[model samples]
Target: MERSFNINSPAEFESISLQIELKNINEFTREMNLNISWQALEPDFNASMKRFGKKVKIPGFRPGKIPRDRLLQQFQPNIEAQFMDDNIQKYYLNGLQEKELVPVNQAEISDVHFHFGEHFSFTAKFEVEPEIVLPKMKRKTLDVQRMKFISDQQDMDVAVDQLRKAHARIETVEDGAQEKDFILCDLQKLDDSGVPIIGKKFEKQLLKVGDGSFTDEQKEKLVGLKPGETARINLPDDREKTSSSPYELMVINVEREILPEVDTDFVKLVNPDLDSVEGFRDEVQNKIGENFDSRSQQSFERELTDAMITKVDPGAPPSMVDNYLSN
Candidate 1:
């Protein structure tokens, strides 16, 4: 939506003219077309020159001693550019005030035209909070599902196991790599002729077997690989195709985490407040229950929001979505 209008000048400036056009790019974005007659800017330009004259240095004369005509002759373009840069936002705000608009973001100024004796015109694009109108409810009450949190002994066990692994000690293993083992290897991409490609070799790279981004097939190949042993594995192509390419992986060392036993000493080490394994298990269970409750509540809220959005279908600003996804 766009509309052309003229902003009324103050009674003091009878010769000044302001032409404004308001354009709506979306529900929350707007562009303002602003044009001001040369009569409106001439007085400000003269005042700006006086301010600049007091500080600007000249070779033949002391500060503030240069004539206005001489200064204009020497630096008219620079002075005009500087004056515009310094006061463009002031005029933009004046236009916003005249139109009774509240911008949510900084205005993006573009298509600026400034002629010393003609006019000064520019376009300013900015975002604003959308006006929200609540629709009349079809029913007196809304029926939303309430989600409940549930946990079991198995869940507690898994959570405890994760905590144990998180604090586990790491040691180099001499035997073959197994599940949950880290393999330090040299991975070199192979060409069609079964030779290493130049500049495609990566050394001392650490890969965790049976976990992370590796596929099941990739994990299987690394399971029985021992130090000094090499294997060829097919990995997904970098070009995002279904085809695979072979790479040579030579294991330099095998590393595994040594988890502590679930004893009184271990429980004390994990938490000073808990001296017994039973107490530690109870704390872990409570934490797991809290986590489950949080997840359940979030899921419920998400579903409810989706349902409401489906009913209303309000427009979401693209900038807000981009900011959310980036963060």
Candidate 2:
């Protein structure tokens, strides 16, 4: 690439013309032309000196005492020319870079001259991004599975349990062990050395004896147990250990929970919008349906995004990646 410059006034302004010749071996050659007319260097230098003279301090005088000619002689031409060169180079480079043009070689500067109070001109040369021929892609289709939401018996049971719990009240019971009761107790484990392990103690813990959560052995241990009653629970052989050692837990104190019966008042307490159990159940069903629909749409959108990206299969250049990383 070759560039030419015609600086009419070295002290005032410059006029530049740029011609770009791009040659790609065994490919194509492209040419581009640009013109720049920057303001004269002398005027800018004089203006800079005038501004500086107003603030510059001289040894023989106070601040703003320096003469314009003296200030120009000291700093004007070099400083003003440097500033103009920086701006002009930035402007030219930005235009080329925006057009994705890369110069394979240094741009040659020619016809360089500068005159006072005249326009500056310059020329630049560069290569551009190569034309890409995309390969034809065969369209292929595949069947995909679609998911739908359906309510099950377990879902109904969970809804009913939540409603029942919401309406239930805690009462002091003086009777025997019952189902769905929270038993508060403390637990201890024996280390391999047969000593009581003291970490992670349970204080006034609540355990619902039934509600289909306890194993048959656990249920048998809890049955007929009262407050302050302590029982030893055998740890399962396959139980996951907290540490890398085996430990055995000894249950202490079994306090049972007493769940209240489900009624219209309970339904009203749980659901402010519903006065009856049936209305609350209807609301739960609607909520479940709405949640399921939202999840289904999200899944569909994700699948569609994957499919679109697969179809496009865009290619990126190394230089483009480097530029992105630099930014």
Candidate 3:
């Protein structure tokens, strides 16, 4: 809105014009120019002085009572500076409203000219949101490498063996002892002439086949032994701490590991979720297939994302890219 001037001066200046021009330098940038007439800005300046007067404090007067001339004389620079800021913002908003333009960031003001009697003018430059032109996309194909896991009979047998071992029943064997068997025997330290050393006998001592504590000779002697069988074997003497000496081992008991049959009760004991061995094998195969499918899907998604990025190289602003790298 242009204000009417009671005395705007020469006939040529009778009508004051507020000029605003917008120049588009590129698709993303625009320059805004504003030329404010003194007639239009004088009202705002007078209004600002009154507003300052209402809030300013003086030595000998109450609030809102200071003389206008005195207040202007005392704080002319501050008042002018504040009024310039407020007027610039007001005029900038007016320019935006008139042109119907939206800026992406705050406008940067340059070449400012402002005064009480002279015309106010400035140039504001800023970037606007760009119009993204998406490329004409055809059907793009991405290749995915997939590995299908199929459980074979050998894999199923291995799985069943593991389950059977986990639920195996361990019992004492009174006959031949295999590689991983256990034995309870009376171990007596003997003298050179085959007499048991007094108080040097370990009674009912438990040991396992292939136990590192025993020498190879001792393990070999105990493998084919039954209850009440006695073997005079040479082992490391605890008293001597370094040398091998013969000892009498009377086998008290022998133990063996027995795996359960793949029956309903045994399957239930091992896996409460599985009903039968065939069902468990099927479930295992299905799980393997599902895992392979999931991996394939993930690979396909990654390929698709990479392909899209390659197709569309969306560049970011220089300032944003610089800031990101700096941090």
Candidate 4:
């Protein structure tokens, strides 16, 4: 790409001209090789070091009093490395402006090389917006299942039951564990060989059954377990941070949950906004309808999105999405 530099060039840009070679990778991507010259960078490099010397602590000399020659000898390499990083983007941007290329995502930079009093150059790959219109396309009429949320008498009764259960009294059950039971157990972390790792145990951890919070393996071993029973649980390696680890759980005690009666008194306690059970049931029905309406809207949006995606040009590179996510 040959274009004149219109933007005011920076003082460190000692090059009278910049060379930018743009190679088309595809309809939406390009590889740009930019060559920048360093006519006089030593002056700026010295000034930057002088400012840094005031802040950098040295053993022999007080801060800001290090001799220029010694300072240059000791920190010159470090300063050069920083200068390349600090100025590479500045030069790349300048070249991009002159050539009028607007990249859609972060450019992949490579082959960077620079020398004092010499030229600095690098190559960068960029994903650009392809200049093409989405062609007219059609698909069989999408059969989005029209969601209907009709909370009848049975649904209202179920909602009331759940509300009552949420305010249930917690009691200790000596007759083994059941659903909605809180178990007090210790989780001991283990190595790959199923041996307990010392100092990695979690003690007195409280877990609620039927909540789907514990791993399926742990829940399966725990549901029928009585007090004083120990279950060796092998957790799955599905978590992002934790792998499959063995745990020896000594069930200290089991607390069974007893739900309150879904009567006038319980309805008054849970639903203070509504005075009677009839009003509370109506509110639950409205909430269910609202949820179904929201889901229908989302489904319609997805249909439109799928249609537009099918209309896009086949040349649209898959890396475009991957590149955007990485950036």
TM-score of each: 0.68, 0.43, 0.41, 0.61
Ranking by lDDT: 1, 3, 4, 2
Per-residue accuracy of model 3 over 101-162 as CA lDDT, tens digit each:
76655677788876556788888777665555667876645444444445577766776788
Across residues 1-327, which tens digit of lDDT does each residue of candidate 2 receive?
Answer: 123332221233233333333334323223333333444244444554456566657678666767656665675655455435544454355435544665543343433333334454444443334455645655555234456667776887787787666555576564646665556666555666657677844455566675443558766776666666666554443446333433332334444434455667766677667888778778878877788888888787777656655655555444455667889
Against the correct fold, how does model 1 do in TM-score? 0.68
Better of 2 and 3 by lDDT: 3
110 Cα displacement, candidate 3 (Å): 1.8
RMSD of each candidate relative to the true structure: 7.0, 12.5, 20.1, 7.8
Worst 10 residues of 4 by lDDT: 1-10
Off by over 4 Å in 3: 1-18, 58-60, 97-100, 141-315, 323-327
User: What TM value does model 4 have?
Assistant: 0.61
Candidate 1 per-residue lDDT, tens place, 85-145, comes to 5566667777887788987556677788885677888888887766766677877335578
* Model 2 TM-score, all chains together: 0.43
Of candidate 3, the 10-residue stretch with the lowest lDDT total is 1-10
Model 1, backbone clash pairs (residues 3+ apart or across chains), number? 0
Query: How much is the lDDT of residue 145 in candidate 1?
Result: 81
Q: After superposing candidate 2, which stretches have Cα over 4 Å from the reference? A: 1-146, 176-180, 188-219, 234-239, 242-262, 314-327
